[model samples]
Target chain A: MWRDAALVAGKDLRVEGRAKVAVNQVAPYALVVLLLFGFAFDQDRPLLVQAAPGLFWMAVLFSGLLAVQRSFSIESADGAIDALRLSRLEPAGIFIGKVVAVAAQLVVLEALLAFGVVVLFQSRLGGAGLLVASTLVSTAGVAAAGVAYGALCVGLRARETLLPLLLSPVLAPVVLAATEAWRAALGLSRGDGWRWLGILACFAAIYLAGGAIGFGALIEET
Target chain B: MSSSSSLTRALGISALAAVAVNAWWGLSLSPPDKVQGQLVRILYVHPAVATMCYAGFGLCALGSICWLWPRTRSPRWDRLAVAGAEVGAVFCAATLITGSIWGKAAWGVWWTWDARLTLTAILFALSLGYLALRRAVDNPHSRALMSSAVALLMALTVVLDHYATAWFATLHQHTTLFKPSPSIHGWQLVTMCWSFVALGLVFAWMVVHRYRLEALEERYESEGYLVAIEARRAEGQPVSAAARPETGRVLVGSAASAERAEALVEDK
Candidate 1:
């Protein structure tokens, strides 16, 4: 399963590497969001620094939406989905592969967005260890959930519009947990970021298990 | 013509009678509350409807579980899940509106992010999403399977959301949890119990009707497909049997499907 997942993830990354959509389009979109946040706050450095954690995660989430949609949209074109089904790969492998691919894209996007926050919002990034751990775990959780829901709505007429409505509310916990963790990591307060990281781990576990088990039925319907 | 129809009819009549009686006692005979005065009257609709909404969602999750289990899988279970979700959506809406009404009287606001209220709102949104998902999928089996899966997820999320919100609210200390009943005695308690019975009966009745509506919709969609097929033949258009649309409802449109659908209705 891990081998197949790696193959699938490698294939996705190679395709993405060729197109560079995440770098050219999504990362810049995240920067644009940061700029907009700065404008919305009227360039008040203190307020922007204080709200940086939430604004950063919010940008990642919105950008993550585009990444997940693009990840599945690649499958829908040129009978790629049918090809994947006929490739004899396990549904679990396919699920894990998609999660890995989306998470990889999101991690890079987060790195860029982190830079944007530090430079644009003048926020201090103090806890490097906690920041990295929270980023990886929360990205996995978001990716697992995003791909699961992305698959759920794939091939439907309303896939584009319906994804947000269905995915966002379900992802409320992830946003809350990640934002709070980032808050603690940014030295905003003395609150424990580990607890929020633990919550993110739980979210990742639930969604990853659900995707692996439920992917067969979801793909079969397509 | 089954015995259950008579039972349903009896239940329906009794539920109506109970509602009428409860309304009279709850609004007229019951003394005003010491704190909120007559504003507590919204309590009758709020708690009963909210309780029924919870029961409806609980039924939906149970039906989904039954449908998903290979040993217990049946179209009947899928139908029950749909029926419960639709009814639950209605009651959930009522819960929000009545709760909002009560909140306005007590807190001078139309809405607040109290823990229970927030959870209720999320449940409402999840149910809407579930129903929307059902409508998006054209195939009957796929719709049933996918919606059941989503319903199960919603059920789990509701549990998680409940606890999360409770803890989050305690941490913030900005809002008090909305609990309607502190201490009730005498007629208020009796009337509240009667309201529960009446609303419970109403919920059962709505589920029965909604289940039949779903079955009828399946049959209708299948018949429409058959009509299109016949029209294509009449127009001398090439109609390949292998190329037929995979509606999965053709069987349900035929006599066996009708019998099975009726059986489910009667069995309920």
Candidate 2:
């Protein structure tokens, strides 16, 4: 099962590795998103610093959403996804693989987006100690959510729209807490950023478990 | 037919009655919140809508379990479940919109990223997306089952949104009417309870009516599909416009190509 999962994950990463498509899509968006934020806040350094958590988190969250919507787009062409499904590999494996790939895409996006935030908004470069970890944690939650909800929406008519819809609401607590934690890390208060991080981790775990347990039932439909 | 028809009528009348009572008590009987004043009136609608949304999601999930596992399946009950969700979406939207209106009146702002309100917005939006997806697919079976599954997922919103208010603490006020927050007496309690019951009845009525409409539409669509399938089958193609036929020419032709090398292992 683990090997099967690795193969699926490897297949996705290999495609992105060769093509640079998701990276290509994610990088520019992350950059412009920061630019847009700068435009929105009108370069108010004080407000930007104080509101950094919300702004950064929202930027990362939206970029992840865009990536997620298109995450399965590659896999869905003609009989490719179905063939992958029919390979006698476990559905859970396929879900894990896709989620991991999505998470990798999100991580790269976060790095580039973070760089843009620091350069454009001049967000405190000193406080990125937990930034990568936080990004990965939140991305895990988002990707697991994307996988679970993505499957449910996959056979639907408007999957592109539905994936984000079903996931983001459930995504609130993590995004909120992560944003809060990121805020605290950015000199907001000494309140437990770790608590929010823990919560985000829990959210990610629940979503991952949901995908694994639920994927089997989903395949029955397929 | 008599039993169901009268039930529908009773439901209809009761729903109307509920609406009338709530409006009366809201507009006239119950006094406004001491601090909130006339703006307090938004309570009657907001809480009612929230409850219906929860109920819609709860019932949809319960119905989904039934729909998923055939042993528990009752088409009538499943349809009723879907109806609950559809009706619930309306109420959820009402909750968000009225809450926004109330927030503006009470807080000097129309909307905020406050946990509860944000979550309510998400729930509303997700259900809207689910509904849109349903329309796009136009497959009756997929719509019924998947929509209910999507609705079931909305239960998570109540948890995520309410978590902060319940645990971490927040500015969103918890309602005292339904929850065990202290106690109130006299006309306030009576009016509030009366409004809740009234609205609850209205919600039930709406759900049943919605279910009936779904059944009607499902019937019409199935008949239409059957007619189409009959035409197609008569036209000599084991017709399937979303119905997967096991072995048909289009698939067979595709299979019959040089890919026939693999055919001995698989039957088409």
Candidate 3:
């Protein structure tokens, strides 16, 4: 299953590499969100620094929507979904693969957005290792959740509007936990970073298992 | 249908009696609290409606799980899920409204980011999303499948949010209603108990009516599908085997024609 997942992930990444939609459009859009947050706060440096963790994750969450949409839109064209159904690949593998591909895109988007915050908002990063670990784990949880819901609305008329509504609330735990973890990493508050990390890890595990188990039911055009 | 109508009628009478008794006992007979005074009146409505809200979503999740399991999967489960979610949404709205009113009287704000308040808001959004999802999909089976999966996910999120809320300290009081050693006594407790009975019956009545509404809509859609399929046959179009009505889904082409047929029928 891991091998099949890798193969599917590789295929999706290759397609993304060729299209560069995520890199060219979504990454820049994430930067714009950073700017929007700055202006929303009236460009107060202290306020921006204070809210950097949440703003960064919000940017990641918003960009993730596009990445997940693109991931499924590739298959929404032609008879691509039917082709996958006939491919004999494990449904769990496909789910993991999509999640992996989306996570990779989100990680890169997050990295760039983190940099943007450092420069634009002058927010200092204190615990680098904890920060990166939290980012990767939280990205996985968001990716799994996003892909699980993204595939659900594919090929529907209101999918574009419905996907965000379905996904955003489910991501509340991730946003809260990840922001707390980031706060701890940045030394903003005397919070237990490990506990927040544990929450993020549990979220990733639940979504990964859920997507793998439930993907088959979702993929079929019942 | 006759039995269900009679059952609803019985429920209506019981609900009325329960509401009347609770109102009289709670508003006039019950002594004012030493602390909150008249403000305590909101408790009778708020806590009971909030409990019913949670119960509605619990029922929705149970229905969704049953529908997901192959052995027990049925349209009735799907209908139950929809009914539960719709009624849950209504109760959820009521909870938010009454809670806000109480908050203003007690906390001096229309809203606060209290743990229970935030969780209830998220649940309200989730219920609305579930209903919106049902409206977006045209196919009954697909709608059922997708919404069932979503309902399960929403249920899990609710649990996680509950824990997360508890994990983080906030203004929302704990160990009140669900405590082993009860908090209040006398007419307050009695009225609260009576409110629960009234709200529970009202919830059951709403779910029954909503479920019947869904069944009628399903019947009308199926009839529309048959009409559309017959029209396609007359046009000599080759429909796929998958377009069979037995599958409980209308093909896209047939769905469009069905909309037209439904419109035409309405015109007649």
TM-score of B-chain for each predicted structure, in order: 0.77, 0.77, 0.82
Better of 2 and 3 by TM-score: 3
TM-score result, candidate 2: 0.85
Q: What is the DockQ of each candidate?
A: 0.57, 0.44, 0.64
User: Better model by TM-score, 1 or 3?
Assistant: 3
- Tens-place lDDT per residue, model 1, B140-241, is 878888788789877885575446545664321221213565366677777777788878889988888778777777777898888666544433433233
lDDT scores in order: 0.82, 0.72, 0.85
Candidate 3 residue A46 Cα shift, in angstroms, is 1.3
Q: Please give, for residues B1-268, the per-residue lDDT of candidate 2 as tens digits.
A: 1224788788778878888987888889888767767876776677777888888877777777777677876677667667767887888888888888988887889888676777778777777766665676675566666666666667666566556577646668875665667355566667667767887888887777777787887787777666555444434432333433332333444323324433433554
Q: For every candidate, how close is chain A to the native chain A in TM-score?
A: 0.98, 0.92, 0.98
* Decreasing DockQ order of the candidates: 3, 1, 2
Worst 10 residues of 3 chain B by lDDT: B239-248
Error (Å) of candidate 1 at residue A93 is 1.3
Residue B211 shift from truth in candidate 2, angstroms: 0.9
- TM-score against native, each model: 0.85, 0.85, 0.89
lDDT of 2 by residue, A53-132 (tens): 67777877777777666656666667576877668998888889889988888787777766776777777754565655
